[model samples]
Target: MPPEDRSTPRARRPLRHLRAAWPVVVTFIRSWGLMALLVAGGLAIAYRFVAPPPPATLRIATGPGEDSAYSVAVARYAEALRGQGFAVELVASEGSVRNLELLRDRRVDFALVQGGVAEAGRGAGLVSLGSVFFEPAWVFLRRDAGIGRLPDARGRRVAIGPEGSGTRVLALALLEANAVPADAIIASPLAGAAAAAALLAGEVDAAVFVSATPGQGIGTLMRAPDRAMLVDFEERAGAYATLLPALTPVRLPRSGFSLPEDLPAEDIVMLAPAAALLAQADVHPQLVSLFIRILQAAHRGRQVFAPEGRFPSALNQDVPLHPDAARWYERGPTFLQSWLPFWVAVTVERLWVLIIPLVTLGLPLIRFAPPIYTWQMESRVLRYYDDLRRIEEEAAAARDRAARDAVEAKLKALDTKVATLGIPSGYGALLYALRRDIAFVRDAVRTLRRG
Candidate 1:
């Protein structure tokens, strides 16, 4: 307690400020206490919508190999993700059936799956990011076989692709729907370039290539010119769609598969299923949203079979859209894409869900805030002064000792009440000043008794 230290401006200033600031501080503390649980619970609920960081690398099951468009599309996705600091590992599989199996088992992070290969048993465990491309069932035949349509190929050697491909699943389903007896057709396991080679070598009567348009097999068969002809679905495209809900009818121009040479002399109608990007149910939403943006960039624009921006479509059966994708289809990309960089946009978008509600509450809370503070400072503590004035007035009018004694008792009780009051640490200066004022009133009563 040095005299110079006590008199220092800094020391006195804080003490004076503390006394002035207590009511504001206490008012805030009380207000915050009332809202603490609500804010905490609301934030906890908002946290559920926050997506986790995308993985450093992702493993996706693509079809057959690099020659296949499914595989090529997956490779493009890998390249795009790589530029964004994420590595996408492409795993070659038999085809759509195998992709579905891998996704069901959670063996891979993502897959290039053919539509309609997914079975109900594992349907709940997976979701589609949207169809990225079309896998058209291209049936190329030897001109001499006289195969004008699907039924004509019966009893002819047909290579629909090997065991588990989406090609095989779709080919068989279409044949069964067309009422082509299974016993009449000789189905071969050869697929891809092998199937195309078989038909060219005269080893098979017809080869069915279920591939993304402009397949290597189709290009190879195009070299045959007049010898190989595309079967026409003609007006039967809608019939096929009506018969099989999963198949979408599409028309390809004479040279849709290859531009320079008119592969087919005229337009031919065909059925195809979209090749979708599918993932396990637990896949991170950030990665789902990230992949869709990248894939849309990769799949958008006109292709041989589909119109520009026709793919990455949410319209498919057998599977639901991934939640992120449903939002994507409804909202048309994350809102942050317009102004911010990719990474920053994703982070902000993830937090934006929480920010909305907090902002909504904060505006009204701040707008109506003055009354609460005024009551804390001007009314609560100041009411003690009014009580003291009433007691002084009663004591002055006292005609007998009993009334004066009652006023003294009330003052002693009031002093006791002030002494025992509990308050926060920051309010200590105000509490100290209040006690000093109470002491002054007690001294005045003491002097009245002596007089």
Candidate 2:
């Protein structure tokens, strides 16, 4: 044959083989298609139970303005989260009260809230990572006001922070505890720098501030010792702490802010509340873990009031601790979390339950499926054995040569049907055995015909 003709036969040979394979393909589908569908369905149902991937974006509520310590701290959090492939939106708010409102409304995923701001029957469906820092009640008074203690501010002008502010809430609580009526002081709605400015300008007799020691307003007031003095809650600190479960008795040692200048000449006792990082109850565990790690790194150090490794603590939290955060604090990160990247670790953790069941049940099913399929295919070829035996008996009982020949012809037709039947190549041994039996029957029939 010419080269071209030889190539044509080679190409046509593939087509013939494909045509021959059509029946085997059909038979295999009949056997295994249902099994494939079942496995797929099982996987889909398992997936439903798995924890969903963490959200790509997170919204956080922080204190008002870029200058606020809350905003600055949350800005750092946003940067860290962004580096780990999350998009963080920082929403500035009036204070902890507004932050709580944003969190309750589901308008933000996380918020920095003061310990005492979340009142009874109001803080539902929220959880805390932990208290990150202390926000002390810094009551700055002008020298002319002659205010030696919290109650002495009665009937005097007081800047009690703005509306929807944690400072305002705490100030009212402390004043009420001191037997100072709400109407007794001329309350000013100014806060932070405005409150500090008002107190410095002699516009207000006293200003109540709830903030970290490093806050700008507190720093500004501390710098001017001649003009303002911080009130000492020495006599009632223990009593106030008992009255409000959120408040902790904190003492600032002599000259805590400035030792050389003898700024605070004596130890100043104050009632301090912790600032907690709050999140929705249903926040993703991965995000919770990440935030907890960030908070530990940020706050687990010595501060003006707290000792080294004292903060990022589960202590003094107004809201319940997040389960994941609690776990992190108790037992640290999981083994996979310690080794793998953030998303990879979370993915594996989420799917681990599904994987265990699949391995346990699926292995046995996989081993059993091939044997079941083999038996089904072999039965297709073996069912004709009974017909072959009946033909052999008819040949043996033939009354004449013509009768024997008719029996032989019937046997030949049966053999042809068996040969033409479509069976998979894997079952060729069964097909050959059936063919050999048919030949045996033919030989016996021919011998009877000769007799």
Candidate 3:
């Protein structure tokens, strides 16, 4: 090389040392290697800090057509979710049982299911977002039929609603409480306006209607003044539970059914149950939390069906609260109704935040940590070189068997130390080779002493 272009030997001295020690540098890099990997992981986790996607399109399962309170509830939920940028689809269902079945099958994302119908095998994958409403049991009888409690209508024709409905389940329980034989009663499985029509037209002497309090059809009937009589269930509550364990005893205040004149003075004994929202166990925690906030918002102030704020409480339902819902309760009441958009954002981003530190600091360290640790471990074995030199000098001038044996034992002990140090799983062969080299040197020293 030309003198002008060439680096002087003195100047290149640092380069030569660096080149010689490149392997040592690489070894150090391998040790504590986890630090670099952990930093990278941390960066990857941090990259997930973007804003969440817009509110999703959801499907809510509601009862019947547009006439039922189930349908009315759907409208209310849709309106609220829409304000939060969610597009909610309302699927028409037969009633609570069908709503719960849809939720179990993943056919709909949400539903309003009455409490009593879900007894034995029906409630595996469901979760209550919270109670949306209480479905009051309204049993109307013909004026002259004189049916006070449920048992009096055993021989008479009755409409309890179609199959797989909350009304049918409750009606069966009411009759069983009265000791009315299932075969003795003429049970008609009709629903909504059809059940009402059957009772008014005298095709059925009594009809059981399960709907929100002051329900439209029952409200219309109550307006007719003495045309039909409401069954008073106050006296027979314990008897009611003995027959149907799931039936909750409640009261419809005198003003609930009365418009122009008070019907009954004090609290009247009535039977009712809450409708719950349920979902699969594996449903995403964020979605579960989001749905709860929306539900609480939809029914914030006054109760649409039961007493104000009483419908959504935890004590009202037959099923246990979803874990996600339980967590929200732990954090105190939800404020999403007042600051919806903010809370929605908060809910979605919370999970990502929790995972951030682990990815950034924990995971990267896990990946890079092993190689770095191996290098440090290898250095401990490498330390035998200095001790071996010192022993070789002492063995050359050994005067007796005792001195020779002492030097040999020291070398043997060092060999064992090197042998016992654990190596990585993939480096087992390398460790064996290192131990074999140490043994070969020790054997060479022993042969020299014999000579």
Candidate 4:
């Protein structure tokens, strides 16, 4: 140790360093660390209540044949939804009656149901987006059937449509209203092209069709006007509409089918029921909104019976309107929906409920947490004053120099501990005051020693 190796670095004092850092670690854990835990807990609770993302896949029930209006319209809907990142599977059923059954059983998420098919008790757990289009009742008769009116079909061969069809439902209701009992007519369970072919071949005296758009069956009947004629419900159209609240009186104008042919030759007044887009009540609100938007794009154009923008309408719905669809109909799309991508807009709308509470609660915490942290830090330093007061009392009561030296030694230790405290810069004034109080105690002890 001759020259003490003058240039050598001193050994590190790890214990003193730990002592200085300990208070800061404790203060942070007691203040900011606890605050962080509180915030994390709040977020966890909020996340539990957050709405989950909508399903990526959707299933819809349409009519039996691909050529039918229900099937064709739903196919277009599937295409549009697929463009927006959805996987759509179409389930073909008999008609509106079967579609309603599929929707109620949860076998399908959505269905195109004719308005009058959903009876009072059968529509539970279902809601309507809106009425998409009108489906008119077309009663086509063989030219020699001698059936002038609905009641004239009594005791005659009639194709009233197959079971689980909207046409059959309307047919039975009209026949019943006209006092034609089910057993009174030879009722053939024929529909679509089968019904059309039966009437053309004279196998059935009459065929009832409830369709929106002209398809193979309707087109065949319209072309063969000489063999088959669409009956005009002119006299009883209003009466039928009144009997069935869902039925609306509509007219198929002359040449409505073919402008060159002057088809119909006269306005054909018919009783029509709207085809409503029905959904399960539990369907996601975002999906409902998306469907409404899709329907708006698809049905806003003018059609044979409806004026432009008259469809996809809140009116003519058989079931209660879905809350989300009602909002969309009332206010149109939200600003976020108008600008952002579909999923992005949905995500923001879903999270908005969570974000609001967090902001409201976090703002006040943010405003006050720092002050609380400072108080905690300063309190740590202030706690030493109790020991300082105790040492001062012992110094004043000292009877001899031995006692006085012991008290002074304790005072020096306390001063060294205070010097090593790791208070933040902002709290330096409180630390300095504590040190000054210790100094005053030391000065009093020294005066006692001298006396």
Candidate 5:
């Protein structure tokens, strides 16, 4: 690049006399130090507060609506999130296993995952908003099979669930606990409506339905034309719950599905695992908070298992809760959060951490910088004044003409230097005063010469 044209720019006269030894460094600090500090502080606060805006839309992995509670609940969450200016997109998947996979791969922002899908541990990089609802283990068998207990299905063909499903996981665990030989049962890969269809068609002797909420498939099985009987887990419900830390004991009241028709003959005891709202660890905190609020509005009611306002819970979650969700659960909302708009409140909360420290340090600097800069400029004038006084004293004591002439030469040199000294126009009075004193010394030296 060609050199910049300084020729036509405003001319700055050279300040040789008053230039300090470390002029560039000292001049820059004195001219722009405070402004640079203020600009940097403002930018720091902006980055902390506004860099991660709430996403306009988020994709969530939910299970097929025909058979999974996740589908139903996710739709409700989508509605709630939309009302708050967020677009919630639903991506249907196989089940909790696929949901976890989607979250880990970053294919989706959120997921409704069943507890205990974390065989070794919660999928890497995943965190939860909270447990939303219980997924009961519902087992159904042919009415004539007369199978009253879980162990009785040892030799009978059973449809666990499809590949990569939490239902398959729980079913295998339960049957294994009953000592049912894996080789003895015809475990099918069919899940959801397919599994229910297979059981009704007599392709499998029984089917196990594991879902966070009651889906159409479970309801279809119960109301099947062949009258398939729902196997009561009464005998082994507690045992299953005890063996599986994730499972909770639940009682499904008789005819809860159809009060007048009395769908089931008696109350059924079962073990169920709760489904949690999960996200990646690095998801924006503001988005997490917004997700929690949507979860709250969508889940603030009595589920088939839990009491009203008991869901969206932080405690006892299978995965660790997102930090923001935990804070919301522990302390409702912050002060500004309660009064101001959500974005405004969040921006303030995020900035205060940086803003508070800058304010604490900046006030002292603002008070002291100007005075220190003034003292530096004044020292230049004082040094010249001291030199002039020494020259005047020597001139007054000189007895010979040669000595007075040398002192006069020194006075003229000092006068020339004072004339060239540079300072802001505001200090013009001080500059003029020093020149007047130099003239006085010059006249005294001439008088000594004449004497």
Candidate 6:
């Protein structure tokens, strides 16, 4: 204390002292650039792998008339598609045969066609949305006439549908099964209101009406008491198969016709094939998914023809499914469809799903990067001196016990804090060297105290 040491201990400023640590600066710059490159590369790859949304409108070919099943179905389907921002156009065709023809020509995006008619025309370009209902072969015979099977009508006058109609295709196949000579069976080419009026007026001996009930033509006839009898197919199941391989024996249960009055005496077995929603193979996947969702939802409550909750099944059918339709039905539809969002949300979701890959791939990299960024920033810090050097400097330069004690406490705190910091496992040697130096300095300080 004789001459208070003019030199006083001062806090070390690592940042100011080592501002030009070029190696650490270069490492930091390299790491930041590499992280950016990794993020961008990952995002670009994800964008390429992502799937896009389908087109906005679907052009569907319905039936010849709005009264027909295909027309009815497409109309209802259009309503469901509104939420998806899809506009459906219902195009007119002569019948199922013409529907298949337009489909072959790629004239339409989707069509509803009778099952067996599309068999011979089957190619890679078609896919099924599911059977909407049974397109039954309805044989309306005069109430007084005694006939049961197709063979009974061999020599009798009959009304088959017009040339290209689905009715004609089904009628010929059925009549031929009964071994009726095409020339002998008097064929009347009539349909719809004309056919229904003809049968009521008794112009034709029998009318072959193919429709869903309360079908426009058939239902009109059914409402008339004893005008025509629905011919049962229980006896001709084997014959139906021989003529039309696609035919399956279905039952018009007595109660199904009229729940209260019970028009049918008993369950009547009848031949049937499923009507399918056929689409071109090239139809986009998102559209196919959207179409199936709408079609399935539309037919959900209909249990009269196809099984309830089973109308949109991808079961037996002639046309192959559009690849997109197959993909959607295979995995089943999404929550958006089942949940039925509003138009705005549905549109946003369709777009959102497309961008999902970008977000999924990008988010993890973004969330995982902050700690890495902080480490990269701090990597440039200059290394702190070992505690022994700091303590020695303090003892040599410190003027009073208070200053010496304060420096000793600060050194101890620095040592404790550094020890707790998680450095690389290989840095144990550096820690051991620091501890050894600290012990040596403490011993030297104690030895000098006895002086």
TM-score per model over all chains: 0.69, 0.86, 0.64, 0.87, 0.71, 0.66
What tens-digit string does per-residue lDDT give for candidate 3 at 1-451?
A: 0123245568886775566456555665665554765666665666577445434778889887687877887788788777766778888888887887888888888788887766676877666777776677888888867776576887989898887687887787778777886787898997767777777777888888887656566765665546677677777777776666666777777665674566544456667777777766666566666677667766655763455666456656567688768867667435553355644655646545646676657665776677566656566556666777787777777788788888889888877665545444455666666667667767866886786
Score each candidate by Cα lDDT.
0.75, 0.84, 0.70, 0.87, 0.77, 0.69
Ten-residue segment with the worst summed lDDT in candidate 5?
Answer: 12-21
How much does candidate 1 score in TM-score?
Answer: 0.69
What ordering of candidates by TM-score runs from best to worst? Answer: 4, 2, 5, 1, 6, 3
Best by lDDT: 4
- Candidate 2 backbone clash number: 0
Alpha carbon lDDT at 78, candidate 1: 82
Question: Tens digit of lDDT per residue, candidate 2, span 298-354?
Answer: 888898788988888888988788888888888987898888988889888998877
Query: Residue 255 of candidate 3: its Cα lDDT?
Result: 66
**What does each candidate score in C-alpha RMSD?**
6.7, 4.1, 12.1, 4.0, 7.5, 9.5
- For model 3 the TM-score comes to 0.64
Candidate 5 shows a clash count of 0
Estimate the lDDT of model 6: 0.69
lDDT of 2 at 325: 85
Q: Give the candidates in order of lDDT, highest first.
A: 4, 2, 5, 1, 3, 6
lDDT of 5: 0.77
**Cα lDDT of model 2 overall?**
0.84
- Which regions of candidate 6 fall more than 4 Å away from where they truly are? 1-34, 143-148, 181-184, 223-227, 255-262, 265-267, 321-451
